[model samples]
Target: MEGATPPASATATTPDAPSARSAPAGRPAVVVLSSLVARGSVGGRAVVFALERMGFPVWFLPTVLLPWHPGHGRASRHVPPADAFAALAADLARAPWLGEVGAVLTGYFGSAEQVEAAAGLVAAIKAARPDALYLCDPVIGDQKPDGSGGLYLPEATAIAIRDRLMPLADIATPNRFEAGWLSGLPVGSTAEAIAAARALGPGTVLVTSAPAMMHRSVATLLVEATRCLQAEHPLVEGAPNGTGDLLAATFLARRLDGMTSEAALPRALGAVFEMVARSVRAGSDELVLAAEQDTILHPMAQVTVRAIATPKPRAK
Candidate 1:
């Protein structure tokens, strides 16, 4: 929150496709994993939406199919690993996908098998496209005030990420709680947050909804090998969900397409903040993020990217 911007709101329904002027050159295509039968939950939709708007062609692998709209209510039964992985592998095997992949971003894995499938696919992608970056938004639950547990992925998922995948991942987007859980550290303060990121880091770690004392609302901070940003947004009571998902997607697309975390972090944070602020002012339960869609390419909100804490090595 050291350098934050004022929020913005729009007056009309904005189109999903952003203006051609700001549209950027296409990057290597990205693949996102989501719930197949989602009612379009906030998290999943945000990933798909942010990637496409940023000028990156996007593909999806649904780990589960919701019986109804995802945000509508409870999730329908999940798609077990065997079924989900077979489908995902087939997509990656297509001849047209041979050499153009730039990155693979995964979110909302629902089962242990699904996590395993995702890990194998991530490895395969790297094997085939050695240059492609891997960005994982481990969609496990972060600490919430209501004590809601994050969606359960088998312990295998965490092990795979920290031990197997993070080494390969160019970036990771974890909320405050997930960061602490994954790193086995206390993330109760900005200092702790910075340490956790570096200690558990594969490379740059984008900690979303990571709590901070400077502001009441949840915060998203970015920590890289050398650059880190502490972005603060005012709390909006009863705001829409999936902000972390949206932020993660935005950051990944920019990073893969060649923006540094310094540039991409502010873009992601500013975009989500303005989008949420607009939704709050409109008195709408759903987010009015159409205005911020362009932030996928050009971030409107400005902030300074700084390193607040020194990186510390973790105990083995």
Candidate 2:
């Protein structure tokens, strides 16, 4: 809420701009809306690079801009004025290349109004191409050292995402804390996570950092209408931020490439895990996506996947 207005240089480009270029034969372009950090691989920086590296052209719009992730230190922040943001969204909605977008992936928002604008753009893309997918990563909060978690974003912005944008998503990737907050259910275990995913309203829900069956490990749960799959791997301590952004982009890219959710889950999880491990091993605070590009294309990290029983509904 307290940020400088984006500079004029950040204004929307015309339809003929390079960002509006079409995708290759099989890979349709993806539109990514998130934050941009000048020096980190978080938000749009991570999402755009990963999608493009996977052969999908990306149209990236920043919801906010910062020198680096706030976790680093105090820095200048820039958020586009609500009207200007809406105008840019309107421009994209009417662009002739709108039909080329196969998916729209949304994450952080600087304001509630930005959510409305982004929701409108997603609706426009869906209208232009009915098959287009929308994946929403509710980038609100994470678990704290005390084992409690809450939103890092403004309550109004989070409410906007939950009420307006989420219902429009075909798939949602939320961390355990976000899953619980969105569904108003406890997500302290795998069973509770499955229930919360089912209640989250998306056809597909991937809960990252889910409780694992094995000690000192973590799981990513993929919940659908009838079946749920769990992908577990060793947790990498001190893994930097942006893993979720990478996961969401990778999963969406895989889905667009015709990979089934069952198949994409493990691949995406493996890529994220490997990226984190490599970054931590390098003793870097940010993901080494560029140096570790091989991990994204061909992840060798092993992850175990299995079907999980969906919890039965409670009756009065």
Return the top candidate by TM-score: 2
Question: Taking the tens digit of each residue's C-alpha lDDT, what string does model 1 give over 1-316?
Answer: 1111111111112342111112234577787876553443265566777787777787777766666544557655756657647565554533244345667887776665566556656655554466778787877665567877763656766665555555556788888888888788988788788778877756888887776546565567888766567777667687777777778787787678678777777777777777777677777666655654555556565544455666544456
For candidate 2, the lDDT comes to: 0.88
Model 1: lDDT equals 0.65
What's the distance in Å from true for residue 110, model 1?
Answer: 1.8
Mind sharing the TM-score for model 1? Answer: 0.79
**Candidate that would win on lDDT:** 2
Q: After superposition, how far is residue 158 of candidate 1 from its true place, in Å?
A: 4.6
Candidate lDDT values, in order: 0.65, 0.88
TM-score of each: 0.79, 0.91
Error of 2 at 206 (Å): 0.3
Residue lDDT tens for model 2, 76-121: 9999999999889877876767768889999999999999888878
